[model samples]
Target: MAERIQKELKEIEKNPPDFCSAGMVGGDIRRWQATIIGPPGTPFVGGIFKLSLTFPPKYPMKPPEVTFKTKIYHPNIDRNGNICFNILKDDWSPAYTISAVLVSLCSLLSSPNPEDPLEPQIAAVFLKNKVQYEEEARKWTAKFAMS
Candidate 1:
């Protein structure tokens, strides 16, 4: 497991994903920290979001637990930073890599999935009034995600 994690780390360092970077939090290979620069042309653009990944002992067989350490205003992400993305849940496969996960997250920020949301109220707003939702999302990004 540690060997696999090290390989992934080296791969990331050699070719870091666009708008994202991740590394071990400390000496523990099982814990990692990642940063995602919100995708361009989105309400989250220019915002920086932080996330934590906790890998289980049997990683690859089981998906890592990912949570946002930085607040983000999105229907798929709740106030507590829990994510509602399917790939991170039941759909996860061992074939998926950390780079793929980060790329998917950037895509999510670019186009959110309001149909299956963690924050239902936000989803309602998103579904009913997209302009309002985008305005609020931009505001939250400015307040909480901008450094």
Candidate 2:
């Protein structure tokens, strides 16, 4: 598991995506902390979103679990930090890697999916109160994710 993670890490280092910065944290080979720079033109812009990645012993076969360490106001994210992403759940595949997951998450920050929502209230906010939603998201980012 560690070897596979290291191999994936090397690939990420060579050509990282533009959204987030990732690295091993707390000196744990199995744990990583990623800092996502909220996407431009989105409510999350200029925000620092922190996420923790924990690989399963059977990772790639079983998807890694990602939870936001930083509070975020999104329909797909729950108050308890669970995310409502299909690929991260029952749709996981062996071909998926840490980089792929991170990329997906970064995309989600920009274009949120309302069809599958973890926080139902956020769904309503997304449809009816976009400006308010952005305000709450920005507030949470400042309170929790700022350096």
Candidate 3:
């Protein structure tokens, strides 16, 4: 498991996904920290979102637990930073890599899935009024994600 984690870490360092970077949190190879630059032309643009990942003992076989450390205003993400995405849940496959996960997350920021949301109110706003949702999302990005 550690070997796989190390390989993944090296893979990320060598060919990192655009707008994303990740590394071990400390000495523990099982824990990782990642940063994703907000996708261009989106409400999250200019924001830098942080996320933490904890790999299980049987990683690759089981998906890592990932959550936002930086607050983000998105329908798929809750106040507590829990994300609602299929890949992280039942859709997970051992073939997926950390880079793939980060890329997917960036894509999610670019195009949120309001149909399956962790924040229902935010999803409602996104579904009912995109302009209003973008406005609020930009506000939150500026307030919480900007450094």
- Taken over the whole model, the C-alpha lDDT of each candidate is 0.93, 0.85, 0.96
**Positional deviation of 15 in candidate 3, in angstroms?**
1.5
Q: How well is each residue in 44-84 modelled by candidate 3, as lDDT tens digits? A: 99999999999999899999999999999999999998999
lDDT of 2 by residue, 101-147 (tens): 88899898888888889988988888898888888888887777667
TM-score of each: 0.98, 0.91, 0.98
Error of 1 at 1 (Å): 1.3
**Candidate 1, superposed: residue stretches over 4 Å from native:** none
lDDT of 1 by residue, 1-147 (tens): 788888998998799999999999877899999999989999999999999999999888888899998999899999998999999999999998899999999999999999999999999999999999999999999999997
Against the hidden true structure, what lDDT does model 3 obtain? 0.96
Q: lDDT rank, highest first?
A: 3, 1, 2
Top TM-score prediction, candidate number: 3
Better lDDT candidate (1, 2)? 1
Ranking 2 against 3 by lDDT, winner: 3
Superposed by TM-score, candidate 1 places the C-alpha of residue 76 at a distance from the truth, in angstroms, of: 0.5
**Best-to-worst TM-score order:** 3, 1, 2
Residue 72 in candidate 3, Cα distance off native in Å: 0.7
